[model samples]
Target: MRVLVVEDELPLAKLIRQGLIADGLLCDVAIKGEDALWMADATPYDVVCLDVNLPGIDGFETCRRLRASGVATPILMLTARDAVEDRISGLDTGADDYLVKPFDFGELLARLRALTRRPAAAGGTEIVVGDLVLDPVTHRVTRGGTAIELSVKEVQILEVFMRRRGEVLSRLQILEGAWDNGYENRSNVVDVYIRLLREKIDRPFGVTTLKTVRGAGYRLDEA
Candidate 1:
């Protein structure tokens, strides 16, 4: 597998490169965030090892930019800071995984393997269907440039619809997608949430993107 190693620390960067190379993995090292961005855009590496502290933009901003640019490569953030907030920030900014500095090489390799095994992140954190957009990271939703507020259940329902935009989804399928195992599918909860989503995401925009597929369930059409 090929990887990009973005770290300003020369020794650590070289060591990582060497370690990966020994494992029969190809790696390209970048000492600056800008360089990393350019390299990542230019090359379709399987994974990226990004350091939080960098020369120009730092890893957080770099990660944010990478997602904004629609680069879906799995990003594994490396950092010396182990604070809870730092980890949260790294994830919020779009890093797929985080490894605290002074980590074991074995763990790093395992994490990389895990990330590569999973599907690459879907076109960054924002999911868009027609003019409707949902930012999974920010929990923000907008349609035709108008901001729409959604409840937890409503957001979950909308996400399900957006992910399967043109496909018809049964209530059971939607329930499984939106709720956990504890949610007893007894009432018309799915219908209620769909109504709420329509009120916010469709009515104001004068569109019926979300529709009831007769004899099936529901479908969200691309506008």
Candidate 2:
């Protein structure tokens, strides 16, 4: 799953991004609410981890504007205060859940999972394409009942393809979906990763579900 973490505390934001990445989730950091708004508009994030204290707009106003613009992405507001009023205000402003500061990492991860499972979320907890299966929450991938070992990036790329199976995706499209703005777009990283993915998900099983479209890009289909 892809996530947008909006927090003015640069150190804390990096820590959160690291934790999310370690759990096989693609994450992007936005230090300001204004930046968060545009990033959310440009990217299809599965969830947003919004901090109540920000440099501009704060979390409440940010959440309100997101809803006003019709961005229904699940939001988990983070705050240093545990006041009931803050919680209520966050919920009233369109936050699906709230996490208090100095929180346990495990709980944060669990809350994110719960938010994404809600009815309003775009995709389900698990995705299946033919014999291939992926559990976004558990970060597990299996083909024909056999477990497939994949790096964090491989999993992210595979998730993107499986989520949009049968659609032709160019290198730029895949890069944008699986990576954050931190990555240099000029590199041939997408092709390298796609080759690595095929080695495990296809060659070993004698299946060619991932196809290369000449003059186009790539497509993931049932073998």
- Model 1 misplaced stretches (Cα beyond 4 Å): 120-223
What local lDDT score does residue 191 receive in model 1, on the 0 to 100 scale?
85
Backbone clash total, candidate 1: 0
Best by lDDT: 2
TM-score of each: 0.54, 0.93
Error of 2 at 95 (Å): 0.7
Question: What overall lDDT, based on C-alpha atoms, would model 1 receive against the true structure?
Answer: 0.86
Q: Write the per-residue lDDT of candidate 2 for residues 22-47, one digit (tens) a residue.
A: 88788999999999999999888899
The TM-score that candidate 1 achieves is 0.54
- Stretches of candidate 2 exceeding 4 Å from the true structure: 120-124
Each candidate: how many clashes? 0, 0
